[model samples]
Every structure is written in structure tokens, then in C-alpha cells.
Target: MEFANEPIFQWMSQFAYQPGMVYAGLIAMMALSAVGFPLPEEVTLISVGILAFMGAHPAHFPPPYEGAPVVNVHTAAIIAFTAVVASDTLIYVIGRVFGRKLLYHPRVHKFFPEHMMKRVEEWTHKYGAYACGIFRFTPGLRFPGHLACGMLRYPVWKFLVIDGIAALISVPTQIYLLAHYGEPILKYLRQFKLVLFGIIGLLVIYFVAKKIHQRWAARAASR
Candidate 1:
């Protein structure tokens, strides 16, 4: 609760204090995140966990209200999982309705891009339907990957089963962990933001460098 003094915590707590607002916010944010909004879903779920742990419910709000409702961690987790599945399903439906045409559209192309789309397509092809499960764990690939699955005519049941399993593993775990062990984990996250970013940057650089080297080696091999 003392962590409410932090700006990020305070911001989330504001919404959390309002009855039903936090669930609505989480649904919107998680849906957008699954569809490729820049904000990561994990962070959002973790924030919700921290807020729930801190008891940032209507009952905790300061004012004339003497008895307010408590925040429901289970409800929050369920909402998050549903939001993720819903968003991913929306994209998959778009791909199914439009088929290959969706991939060719200029605006959609921007999200997939040519090279990145190719990589995702390759993985999906190599792994078949299971790619849905794999892509669930790979952030940059999720949008294009799921879209490709539908465009490629993957079965609906398969997509749902694979994706749901992956989401079950990821979405609920973060919420449960933070809801229970939130204080220390949140403190660690706040303290290590810079470190986390630095590691992500380094990984990006390494992958780019490795790709460049591979291309160079291929060209030299023909000579």
C-alpha cells in the first residue's frame, strides 16, 4: 500500500479505487496489447496484480463511504485471460474473412512488414498449427503469426486450443504471482526497469548483427 506513493502505482490505483473500473481498464488494455499495442501485456497484468495486492479497491478509497467492495483478484485474472483470447480471435477472424487479401492490404502490411512476416510465416509453416502456441510466447511474432495461421487456413479448434493453452500458462501466472507475492516482485521490477531495457536492447542488437553475418556468409559461399 505504501507503494501507492509511486507515480505508476498511483495512476493505476486511481482506476482501481473506482468500482469495476480496473476490470474495464484491464480488458481494454489487454485487448489492445494482444493486437500489437506497444504496451506489453505482462506489465499490465503485473500492475493489476500489484494493485490487487495493495487492496486498491473501492473499499480502500478515502471518503464518505465507510464500506466499499474489495478488489477481486480472481475476477481480474479471468478478465485478463479473456481479453487476450478475444483480441487474438478478432485478428484471426479478420484474417479468415479477408483471407490472403488481409495480408496484402497496405495498413495491415505495416504491422506485418515483408521480412518479419516472412520469418513468422516460415515458423508457422515449419511448426504447423502448433505455431499458434509458440507464437503466444514470442511477442513480436504474435500478431503476424496468428494472422498468418488464419490466412493459411488453419482450423479454428486448433487455433483456439493451442492459443488458449499458451495464454493459460502466461496470463494467469503473472496475475497470480503478483496478487500473492506482489510487493517484492513489484519493487524488483521498479528498481530494475533500466536493466531490463538494457538487456532487451542488447538482444536486439545481437540478433541484427547475427542476421547480417548470415547474409554475408551466404553471398560469399556462391563465390
Candidate 2:
């Protein structure tokens, strides 16, 4: 596919021959993303998926890589699932240890602003421990939402069970599907890139507008 030539894909291709390094990099990226790294966790997951695809179809790759050991899709998926849960559990531990006091730390407060924290509190109250599932689904809210789950003292077991289920549904599925069906998927993506991007743009605008309206309502309520 044309995307194989893209810079990010090209970079990932280098790891096609080193399964160990690929797994290590995946764990590192997931850990960093869990702890407020600027990059999205999906990017790393997608890269891993692509790399797994390359490994299975080594003939598509050039030179030495064609005969080298590479990432296995199933193993990659397992590592991804474990890494994500571990990273998320770490965030929960931090919140539980620090309690609400953690929220007010200068470094932390900036990430979980007053408005955002208020929403997190509302979700916790509304959904109880089940809100952990919501947090797992929403990328922008994951870090702060998971933190609030711990701060509010939801049972650690419940958080793990719920988050683990969500992670299972999301993490491994991406890798398996991409590795098995990369060519068709890439072809479709290239064909409908504009349509897909436009839909994404609209979703972003809708969420931004919703947030602004919520903030305005909050301000009015205070008055």
C-alpha cells in the first residue's frame, strides 16, 4: 500500500526484523501515553499492528528483513493488552495513594483543570464504578477519568475488571484485524481518506461545541 512509504510507516518498518525491540517500544509508548504523553496511544497501537502485518508478509519488505525474526500478531496483541492495563493501573495507584490532594498539585492541576475535574466528579457520582468503562472509551478523558476513579475510592478490583474488559475489546482487536487484513484496509482508507477525515473533523467540532456549552451552563449555574 501507498502508506507503507509514509514516514511513520517507514520508521515502523525498521522494527519489522526485531520483535523484541518492537514489543519494548510498544510498552514504552503505552506507558508514556498513559502518563500524559502528548501523543495518542492509538498511534502506537496502529504502528504495532502495521509492523505485525509486515512481519507476517516479510516478502513485502526489502533485503535482510525478509528472512529475519519479526513481531507475531498474537504476541503483540497480548503485550499491548498487558502494557495498557499496567499503565492504567499505575495511574489509579497514584490517585489512590495521593487521594484528592493529588489533584491540587500544581503540575497535576494543570492537566485536570477545575472544569474538567467537575465533570469527572459528576461522572463518578452518576455512574459509580461503571464510569471506569466510560473513561476507557474516551481517550481525551482517560487519564483524568481514571485518576478520579481512584480518588473517589472505587474498588481497585472493579476498576481493573472494567478497564481490562475495555482494553481487551480495543487493544488486541486492532492488532489482529490490521495484521490479518492490512492490505484491504489500507486500500479502503486510501480510497476514502477524505470522507473519513471529514467525519473525524465533524466529530471534533461537535465535542468542542458541546464542551463550550457545558462551560457556559456551569458558569450560569454558579451565578
Candidate 3:
């Protein structure tokens, strides 16, 4: 697979004008992603970041009408963090609830890709499912990472910590970039062919590691 293209960004950009749209959208996006439905967050994040830069909302400062100082970067970051945490928390609940039977059942297999399922199996074995943190930003496996965590029987606290750490690393940078450069970064993205390919390459590495780990684990079990 490949990193997402302009169309995804374009679609998300359409929602930029709606009031409080990104607040809702950000929550939904993270929630859905946590549940194993993958959407490229770059567009959603950039849109939110840029909109904050524009008048749709302010990134660092609260609106003038609040009769108080506008929300600052620190506050904005906290709010953004809350949205992601809420979404990931829901997915963690799904994992805790349905993990044991997810892959063994026939219906789920139909909905999920077999190869990726096998890969997740391997990755969970190696990293103990909390590795969802590691796979959180991987191109194709970000959502699957959550499902894999459940399948591996990862503890909730460990899963949360790992996922939280990963989010802190990824979310802030996207927000910072958008807050500063706004939509222009999106334009720059269109021209960066190499970056798109690099993303695909990283995803390739992620799956490749999964395959290797699975093989190694099977060998160890047999021994």
C-alpha cells in the first residue's frame, strides 16, 4: 500500500469551515482509528492545525469573545491530547472485551485480511500487543495495531502507556507544523514524491519485521 494522497486531504479540507468541526472530527478520527478503521490522520490533523491558524479557530490563543485570554498552545495541546486519549481508550476497551475470540471466528476473518492477520499475530507475539504503540504510526497497520494488541492479550495500562507515548511523539509535531505553516505544508506535501515512497517503505519494513518475528517465534515454540 501507499501513503494517502491529495484526495484525502481535499476531502478533509472541505470540513475546515464548519464550526467546532475538527474538535468532533479529531475525536471521531482517533476513536475510529483505535477501533481498527484506518484513515490517514495527516489530512485531518493538518486541517485542524491550519484552521487554527486561520480564523476558524485559534491554535495558541482563545477567541477574543471568550472575555478572557484565548486558548494558548499549551491549552490547545492538552485538548488535542484529550481527544486522542479518549479515542484510544475506546479501542483499548474493544481489545479487552473481544480480543480472545477475534481471529478464531470465521466472520471476523472475512472482514479482516488474512495476511495482515497473520502478521499481527506475529507482531503481538513479539511485542506483547502493547506494541500497538510501535505500530500506531505505521502506514497501513496503525488501526490494526490496536486489534493486534487485543489479540495478544496486552494489559490495559501497558497498552495505554505505550499508545500515549507514541501519540505524544507524533501528534505534537503535526499540530506544531500546521499551527505554524497552515495549509502551505499540504501544498509542499504534494510535491514530495520521495516522502510518499518513504512512508510505503516504512510500512514495508513493519510487515517484514512482523513476518520475521512470527517465524522466529514459531521456531522457538517448536524447540
Best by lDDT: 2
Task: Give the TM-scores of the predictions, in the order they appear.
Answer: 0.77, 0.80, 0.63
Q: Runs in model 2 with CA error above 4 Å?
A: 1-11, 63-66, 189-223
RMSD (CA, Å), each prediction: 6.3, 5.0, 9.4
Cα lDDT of model 2 by residue, 54-148, tens digit:
77765565436336788899899999999999999999988989888886665566555577778888998999999988888777678888888
Tens-digit lDDT string for candidate 1 (1-223): 4544667655655554453888888899887777766556776887778767766433333423555554568988898898898888888888777887777665566445457788887897799999988988987778778888888878999899999999999998898888788767766767886897688688668756654664565456546
Ranking by lDDT: 2, 1, 3
What's each prediction's clash count? 0, 0, 6
How much is the lDDT of residue 187 in candidate 3? Answer: 59
lDDT of each: 0.75, 0.80, 0.60
Winner of 2 and 3 under TM-score? 2
